[model samples]
Target: MINWKVRFKNRSWVMAFVAQLMIVAQMLLQGLNALGVTDFQLTDAVQQSILTFVNAVFILLSLMGIVQDPTTKGMSDSERAKTYKEPN
Candidate 1:
């Protein structure tokens, strides 16, 4: 079984997954449009808006992940430095 909590803790991974999902959705939509099943299409302004929204979401998630990282939680500067140091 997948550990959803652990998977979602890394914001970059979540962002990349969402981006791939969006690309797949766009491809499906394009296929449907070509088949004339639906006349759906996005204008340049709408596309720009979606891009901006996705970027904002990515930034917010990144900040939240940084703030919630368990390794550095409640650690003082010296302690954190030691914890993060190379083993060499």
Candidate 2:
């Protein structure tokens, strides 16, 4: 089973996933709009706001992820082997 805490520990991954999800949602909304089920217009203002928000969020996430201390990340293969005394 996947560990939710471990999977979501990386800010960059979460941000990128959210950004991609937004893209997929936009596509689905557009499809709905085309079908006359909704009026999801991509006006210049709306486009600028949503895209700008997503881009800014991604940038922030990347910066945060890069700034995290290395110790908090899982050990490297060499470090793990040395610490665990695994056979070669």
Candidate 3:
């Protein structure tokens, strides 16, 4: 019943999409770092510290986006079942 048109009128779907992708990207980066596929100029502590900070920020942003945007969260399992009910 909510009017999502106004809800997402000026929203940044792309940013949310990218933020969601960042987790996967971070995983890939970690894999590559472990495999020695990329060069890391910083010490392990410095690299871990920076990545930790970034991951925290990205998680916070993604949480905020999902909370604020209805579409991203989708409907609940019970709510979807309600849509199929037949009136007697």
TM-score for every candidate vs. truth? 0.45, 0.46, 0.50
Clashing pairs in 2: none
For model 2, how does the per-residue alpha-carbon lDDT over 1-88 read when each residue is reduced to its tens digit? 3234543565644656676677688778868988999975789898889878976775676566642334444533334433433233
Overall lDDT per candidate, in order of appearance: 0.60, 0.60, 0.61
Local accuracy of candidate 3 as per-residue lDDT tens digits, 11-52: 464466566677788789878988999876578799899889
Candidate 2: regions farther than 4 A off: 44-88
Candidate RMSDs in Å, in order, are 10.2, 8.0, 8.3
For candidate 2, the lDDT comes to 0.60
Query: What TM-score does model 2 achieve against the real structure?
Result: 0.46
How well is each residue in 1-88 modelled by candidate 1, as lDDT tens digits? 3344544555655666676577678678768988999987789799789868966765676566633335544533334344433321
Error of 1 at 65 (Å): 17
